[model samples]
Target: METLFWLEDSIVGMTVSSTQWGYPIVLSLHAIGMGTLVGVALMLTIRVLGFAPAIPVTSMAPYWRVALGGFFLNLLSGSALFCGNASELFFNWAFRIKIVLVLVGLALTWWLVQICVKRSDQISPAHRILAALAMVTWLSAIIFGRLIGYWS
Candidate 1:
């Protein structure tokens, strides 16, 4: 598409593709963001599933801010990376699957968070199921994202 070509040829794309440090730095940041986001989600999901009954679920609520920060970081860095190779990525099956998984994971995460926050004292089986689903979805998204590098 013309738009993809334009984005790939844009200044941001040029910097990411041309500069020696640009791609690495942005990619590293993306990884850090993914770790931060997924780590928090996993921790929260574990807690919600009653792994650490000693710790209150309400305490985990604040970590959502950290997850949100990581999401924004990923959004920005991912955008830059995509701009660098929009044409290739746009048609990449792995990339498309990753995007869908991310969306579903985010929805599940939000639902899990709401359950945790609203019923901190009582985690129903449904809540646990949601938390497990969120964990799996997030992990799958990460896997698909990694596959993008080798998907060709």
Candidate 2:
């Protein structure tokens, strides 16, 4: 309780919550990061599921750097956002679900990436299943995140 209050009272939190432009800027960056991270992952997942047979799965490995960049961006921005409302968000069911989904989605994505990078040939059935799970997990995370504001 004390820690949450301190976080909410921190400089980063105050800036994000008090300044009109601050929240918008941070929220926009979060959105951009989410789009970059999820968009690239979705593309790779689709390709692995046999959507674009022309593009080699191995070639998609290079795009992981873009996803990593977005991940870092989100890490920074999300921390700030959370600090701004630490006490309330900490108890929010939607926020908790979103965090769990993000973790699961990240793990699934990493596993899929390893398979894609190691095997230059066709993706195995198991790997395709992992990709599908990652897709669903990430999309669920997004939906839950969006629901946080409206959730009681």
Which residue pairs overlap in candidate 2's backbone? Answer: none
Q: Which stretches of model 1 miss by more than 4 angstroms?
A: none
Q: Which portions of model 2 show Cα errors greater than 4 Å? A: none
Predicted candidate 2 versus true structure: per-residue lDDT over 1-152, tens digit per residue = 99999998999999899898989999999999899899988988888888978878898888998998998889899999999999999999999999999889888888898887557757889878988999999999999999999986
Error of 1 at 11 (Å): 1.2
Strongest candidate by TM-score: 2
Tally clashing residue pairs in candidate 1. Answer: 0
The true-versus-predicted C-alpha distance at residue 115 of model 1, in Å, is 1.5
> Model 2 — which ten-residue stretch has the worst lDDT?
114-123
Clashing pairs for model 1 are: none
